[model samples]
Target: MNRLNLFAPDVRENPYPFYATLRRESPVCQVDPNGMWVVTRYDDIVAALKNTQVFSSAGLRVASEPPHLQRHNPLSDSLILADPPRHSQLRNLIGRAFTATTVASLETRMRSTAARLADEMLQRRVVDFVPDFAHRAQANALVQLLGLDPSLQPNFQRWTTDILSVAAISPDDERRMQDVRRSIDEMEQYMNDLLASRRRQPGDDLVSGLLRSRVNDCALTDEDLMGFLFLLFVAGLETAVTLMTHMALILARLPGWMDRLRKELDLIPHFIEEVLRFEPPVHATMRLTLADTELSGVRLPAHAVVALLVGSALRDEAKFQDPDLFEPARRAQASLAFGHGAHACIGAFLARAQARVVLEELLSRCRRVELRAERLDWNVSLNTRCPLALPIEVIPA
Candidate 1:
């Protein structure tokens, strides 16, 4: 597939068909512009994700770091790019703040925020789900969880957009690159200030918990803290935001399911899980070969870029029966939405909690959701899939 470019608009619009084709024709084939290998089969992707020794997470950093934006991208230094033993140390230290009880404790407050947002949206009757509900819900949840100033909530969307843009920049987009650089500086400074403030007078927040957390009797250095906070802000907010938006889209298109969910509230969790498996927020992830490795009998040279098509893997016919159908209660297998192994999202619990709360609130407030737009406008990105805007009319309960 020499002409294939995942970032191209056509492919990004609906990649599943392409993924299905690739999985059938060539499960491991090199794609265009950059001869990065794309692995589509479920077992192969799982094996590659688990075998981190051969497939390094540093590939994420490599993929994001273009020549002009090398040291400036905060994600380059974040935990997502690190491999063990450094990855282990960071995960062990930071994982303390995300315990089940702690994440659960934040739900009441999250639901409260969601309830307010839902009421406002339902009162409006017609509104864009992305900004009106999903983004706001996720932003407030992040603020509550991290004890960030509520005033700063407005900047979360911009920061997340600019920072993640680094991963999908076009060669000639100097203007976009400049924006990303500035956003990186601003976000890094904010994180540093927050870290210092937490150190002086700790609060009942994730930042303070991290300040107090220790690994092998050593406190996290300034760089580590800042990098982690950057990662946390983007991953924590974006993943859940996308998930909520996807749920809204589903509701808009599948109105009957909304009624089902409202009646069988218990099925909400299953619905979310199915969404994770079917319409995952992230479709793929990058990994670099640390040494020469072979995947599905295809030889890969050292330092080759590999895209683990987790979205495709989730729909692999081998792993999931009738993978194309959205089955909420089919007994889900392991999902790579938050990923697998050491590099799996540490904030997965918090993301899931926020989605559940927002979804439940929306269902309670609205009897049905109908899209105002004629078609979906997907956000342009390399790996993630979500609508840029979802204008919907909510019928109040």
Candidate 2:
């Protein structure tokens, strides 16, 4: 059989069919050329996520680093690259700022923001839902939640996109790395200033919260503070933006589902889950084998990179009945969308709340949302699954 070229344009357009074929033929197949094993079956992917010891996030980071960046190993100790105890410590320190109460309280504000954005879109008639609605709302919500200055919104957005772009392709490109380094330097300087100001006079924001957090009986160091800030700015904004954009595009395409959702507005939560399953914003997550491991009887050497095709796992027929079909009503079951085990998204609750508020407001306020363009363009990134543009006409209620 021919090798599966996931990067091929045809595969990117609609990869489910190929994924199904891979699951059937070789659930754990190695793309020898890339030195990466691709896991397609749902069960194996779940196992890999849960079994962090064997399939480590450290390997994932190294795999993600571009060939040029691999030499310097710039991200040697980032939270996402760490394993076990250290990962737990760092994650816990940052996770404190995103507690349930903290996120829940933001719902009212998020709802207000979503409604205001949707109302404005209605006034415009034709709207690019991605940038105007999804991107703006997600970015604004995150900025407010993190307590960053509103003036930094545009710069933050640009830096977030550039960082993710670097991750998606050409991790080692010197010019791009230089640009990223410059952005990081600026972000660090801004954050350090903010941290110092917060130290003098504390405020109700994430940076302040971090300043208050203690690890190993000591206040967070500058490296810890800056690293956490960097992680939050990129992951918090990019994932939420992509998820919102994908949700909008999917609803626009599947009018029947959209109509049903409009009628049953309370089902927005379930609908979001289905969207995560059907067209997840995070297509794949990379992992490395910390120790020699066997997956589905295939022997993998220690340090071997493995790319878990999360999109494929979500639609794995063996796990979910009629996986391809969008069924939000399925009995409340767990999915790997937010991931599983320890490294699961700390901001999952916040993301869901934000998405729910956006969809709820859109459905309640808009009478009809019709697609204005023939083809929707998707952002070409390996990790993030989102559309570049989703043009639609919003008819007010």
Candidate 3:
């Protein structure tokens, strides 16, 4: 059996070359230590993602059951981890907040929020863009979306960070697992308080909307509400922050692209899509097989763990021309960055809207958001790899 360390720092930092080799030599290979299989080819991953019957989305809670700190335990309840009638029900119920009109309505507020953060970044001697700008913008957008106090942005950062840090760890690592549990407990408490207040005041926010919505005559129970909130808490802002950070790194390299963007504002959306292809925030997602199955001629056992390396697939030579190169104008089909099928990212448009607004601000205000390309820090985990700190200096345009 061939093996690869999905958690290795070097691999996490630059997994493209390794993924190319994996895709060519062994598209479906079993990895030791964790007894997991990896899917490196784009087509195989797409097939797996779309084939929810064979590749079940269950067992998301298994890893975080005991010694693990999980973002959402009993994950079966969450839409991301659910299937069939239940999944459709939840997605339809939550889909209202992200409708095109709703997001368009929020554009002004989102842009204003990004502009304020951009101004703050401009004032800094040397700003760590993650915490200083991208993280702040994401936190603000999420707070308003959920009707939470703006002062709790730091808390959101801590809770999401702690919860996400436990990915791919040994379930027996009790120490880290306990820490994750504590974070989840604290965040859940905060969520409970918010839910109560929303119940009383019934504001015009996502939580309140979910509280009022009933899909197929089904309403949100207390458990369902908490699970849904957990999904948004982790998924809502984290991807946007990472996407902005990745774009900053890219813009720093193509210092002249800012001027190009100014001349052709239309390229902004394409540029964001390319960034998602080249350096997506999420690298992999886990699925358990419902029955013994075959993927790309490789046999997989029933109840086995398989990791769909969509991040690697995004850079597959078979899928994209010059897969390793970052070109802003590349015309291509949608990448698996936002995932596919029933498990696809529901907040995709909302996140993209936030990223586009902030990104426009960046290109317009800064002569170039400068970063030391070679010194970038990345979060190395089983699921995603995101830039940790982009020490950027903004030269006002």
TM-score, cand. 3: 0.94
Ranking by lDDT: 1, 3, 2
Encode model 3's per-residue lDDT on 230-323: one tens digit a residue: 8777877788887888888888877887889899898889888988898887778888888899988999998888999888889888888898
Error of 1 at 76 (Å): 2.2
Each candidate's clash count = 0, 0, 0
Model 1, residue 183: distance off in Å is: 1.0
Please, what is the TM-score per model?
0.95, 0.92, 0.94
What digit string (tens of lDDT, one per residue) describes model 1 on residues 97-140? 65777788888999999999889987889999999988888888
Against the hidden true structure, what lDDT does model 3 obtain? 0.79
lDDT of each: 0.83, 0.76, 0.79
Q: Which should have the higher lDDT, number 2 or number 3?
A: 3
- Ranked candidates, highest TM-score first: 1, 3, 2
Model 1 regions more than 4 Å off: 1-3, 170-172
Q: Backbone clash tally for model 1?
A: 0
Question: Higher-lDDT candidate among 1 and 2?
Answer: 1
Model 2 — which ten-residue stretch has the worst lDDT?
Answer: 68-77
Residue 32 of model 1: what lDDT? 61
